[model samples]
Target: MKTFTYRTATDTAGGLEPGAAFLAGGTNLVDLMKLGVATPDVLVDVTRLGLDEVTSLEGGGLRIGAGVRNSDLAAHPAVRRDFPVLSQGLLAGASGQLRNMATTGGNLLQRTRCRYFMDATKPCNKHAPGTGCPARQGDHRNLAILGGSEHCIATHPSDMAVALVALDAVVNTSQRSLPVSDLYRLPGDDPSRDTILDHGELITSVDLPALAMPSTYRKVRDRASYAFAVSSIAAAAKVADGRVTDVRLAFGAVAPKPWRALIAEEALRGKPATRESFLAAADAELAAAEPLKDNAFKIPLVRNLVASVLEGLTS
Candidate 1:
């Protein structure tokens, strides 16, 4: 490994300095550095600053410190009981040892698992600037077709993040608190960047608001567990008087970000919770889906998964 300056942060406002990257658990950053995907001049270790904690907020929301380990978050009794989606998502990733070392913040910032993005030899906009994206035309079976531009086709890779978006979670940063929905940037003109966070900003915590609605996360991949998603759905529904009052739906692997299917939610709200209504809502969200030649199956897969998730939520 190349030598680099390293420091331990003392406070949240502590400077990371230009050309320096914040180190939480080093789960993702260290791996990227070894692959030559990220080469920072300095690494500011924030693990010593005591940001690891899980606290209940005044309302029904929960506050999770950035430094909190994945294992802890996944196994927390409160999380397992109140936010099973979050627990389920985390438990579905990596191994027990890895989850113990991985931090909540690092997981959110984890880059796409796209093969092109990870392989230095391949042409990927996310890995090399202005080199162009090969996945757009070459191999796109596992890539994102929605919200993708001519520059890139990589999908965001975080099962927990998808659940967080559906739960209306907010990300607290050193600079400012941003909604999880607003954290990701669409791969439009710049596919190299995944989020709107500026350089040197450290994620402090993730705050989730009170959700009276029923929520669930459903992920499908080639492998049964510990594999990246091919298509997944995170959904929350509020049912009253046998009618859906409100709903939140986010689809993964189909878009550049954890795509919130608002059109589908709108269609389901105030409607009877039935298989037909659920399918209609899923169709509304995927109406504009433009699938690639090899990955056209994702269109139906996402639609069916969304329908299934909503169906289960109602049950």
Candidate 2:
């Protein structure tokens, strides 16, 4: 551990130093620091910036501030009524005490819980790029199956992000606003970089569009509580007269970022809301997956999860 200076940031700009990291909730950052994965020389406390409000948008949408805690967001009346998927996703992660401290932006920015990434002794491309990824040949039963590169196959650990991606949420940062899909980048050649944010940039809020349809989030994990997802699906569908009118899907614990199932959505549009259609659409998307040796079960796991989520939505 390194000695560091601590300061409280009153505003969004002009407080960030060269090696400073914003601290809202230290749930993930503190863990990484203790593991020697992150060593910052400065800690900027942004918890009192007054960005914790969950306000209603003019057009029935919702705008959640970055500092809003996960527990509050999940239990908000508007969120529970309009975006049940997001609520379910938030509740599915961590524990009650941790969720009370975890913020919206912090949750979105949480790094992978990969054992290799956390182990400073191991060689992980995500922890130290160009070194090598031991999980590629080591214990990778809980790693990624889709959107992985030769350099890294670490799965993202955020359940809220998966739901937000499915809901087409936009991330508002101090630098610029972008879709949640564009917020995270796939590990192509640079596994060290987790997001597309520049240094000193800070997330301010997240905007979620109003969705008036059946939506759900489901996670399959090693245990029932306080466990990361082994395979998860966040889905929303609008079915009318036994045919799918519109649909959106995003997968978690299967890629570097939330795997938006655009191909599956395209295949399901205007198709009958039947088990066969769901299976075909799932197969269409899972066909591109390249599962590793130990994680091959994720191929069928994701396929069945996608189909089951859509089936439940339609029913």
Candidate 3:
């Protein structure tokens, strides 16, 4: 690891000094630093900035401070009652100890679990641009199958963000407010940049809209607990009298970011909430998947997860 300076910010202001990075819970950042993937010249401690509250908004919305702990957020009564998917996703990620230490903003900014990106000796375009992405030809059973590029194929590893997408959550940054969906970016030709936020911008809070959607988060992984998602689904459906009135679905561990299943949602609207309709809707969204050698199973995994979760939500 590189020698670095550390400081704490009393207020949210000013662009980051060159080569500076924020420090919240340090759950992910510390690990990356140890692996040599993140080598910042200075660590700005924002844990004391007082960004750790969950407040009810004026319009029945909920505002979550970026520094709020994962475990606390999951246990919040309002979250469990109004945004079940968000709470469930938070509980499903990591282990009990990690959930106690992880922060909402840090969880949203997790790096890929791709091995190549972590091994400093390996050639990974995401770690060092133009070095090449060996995962394309190597072990990529858990990498992205959608929104990837020749430059990289790493999947975002955030269960919480997937649920946020389904809830139409908005991210509030020091710069501006935008939909949580717009926060992430596709790999395209540049895989190093995971989010569209300016390098100096700080995420302050996340806002869940006034509209309510009783939803759930389901994750399939290699193990029963403390495992990264192999394929995960966050789904919300509105069905009345055996007909689908509305629906929302988002996928994780199958794309570069939390993928909104827009096609599937569009297909299921006003349609019968039956097994056949669910499968067709799932298929419609997955038709564009471009899986590689080892991860092709993700396509079917995501498809089945979407169908099954939507069925449960509707039934």
Candidate 4:
């Protein structure tokens, strides 16, 4: 093991330096460092900066600090009542022990679950810059089907982020507040970068806007627990008199970012909450999907799952 130094940061400016990295729960960062994927010379601890409070905002929404644990956020009554999709997504990830240590901000920014990215020996653009992505031709069943580029096909693996985007949450940073919708970057040309966050900036809190809609998060994975999503949908809708008033949808494990299905939501707006409308919306969103040879199954799977979630929201 190489010798590395650890320091406790009093503030963001003083603690998180140019080359220094923040130590949240150390669940993902530590594992990557051990795999030789990430090697930081200095680990700046930021848990003691009083960033672990969960409070209700005056606007009838919730504000979760960056240091708040996943287990705590998942079990909170306010989150369960207003943002059930978030609670469901969090509970579906990690074990009891790991969730107890994983932070909310860290969970949103978790890297892809791509096998090539995890294995340093392989050619993964996410793991090693300029190294060509081998998964574009090799085992790509679990790879992205939408918004993928020739450079990389690794999917975004955060269930929490998918839920947050559908809920229309905003990410609070030291520089300025960034809407959670604008945080992710599409894989149009640069699949190497995942998010738009700048260096030396830390996520302080997440603000969920007030909504009078019903929402749910559905994830289909290989296992029942502790597994990354194969395809997931987060749907929030407001229905009145059997007509869809508003709709917000985001998909996971199908793209480089939380794939927000704007076309689907637009199709559902002002339409009756019927199976026909839901299927049409799903078809419209999946029309542009370009799947690889091995992952062609994901195209139909994602379309069907999106329709199912939309149908369930009708009630």
lDDT top scorer = 2
Worst 10 residues of 3 by lDDT: 9-18
Q: What residue runs in model 1 are displaced by over 4 Å at the alpha carbon?
A: none
Clashing pairs in 2: none
Model 4 misplacement above 4 A: none
Candidate 4 per-residue lDDT, tens place, 1-315, comes to 345799887875532556577789989988888887777878888788788988998878999998899999999999999889999988878789999999988887788878888887888877787788889779889989988888888899888889988888899977778889898887656666678887767888999888678889999999888888899999898888999999999998999888899998898899999888888898899898989888888878887887788788777
Worst 10 residues of 2 by lDDT: 10-19
Note the residue pairs that clash in candidate 4.
none
Model 1: clashing residue pairs? none
Q: Report the Cα lDDT for candidate 3.
A: 0.91
lDDT of 2 by residue, 1-315 (tens): 777889898897634768889988999999899889888999999898999999999888999999999999999999999999999999999999999999999999999999999998889898888899988889889988888899999999999999999999999989889999999999999999889998888899999998989899999999989999999999999999999999999999999999999999999999999999999999999888988899999988988998888888899
Residue 242 error, candidate 3, Å: 1.2
Instruction: Give the C-alpha miss distance for residue 182 in model 3, angstroms.
Output: 0.3
Global lDDT of model 1: 0.86
- Model 2: runs farther than 4 Å from truth? none
User: What are the RMSD figures for all models against the true structure?
Assistant: 1.3, 0.9, 0.9, 1.5
What local distance difference test score does each model get?
A: 0.86, 0.93, 0.91, 0.85
Candidate 4's C-alpha lDDT?
Answer: 0.85
How well does candidate 4 score on lDDT at residue 162? Answer: 90
| Cα lDDT for residue 63, candidate 4 | 94
Q: Tell me the RMSD of model 2 versus the true structure.
A: 0.9
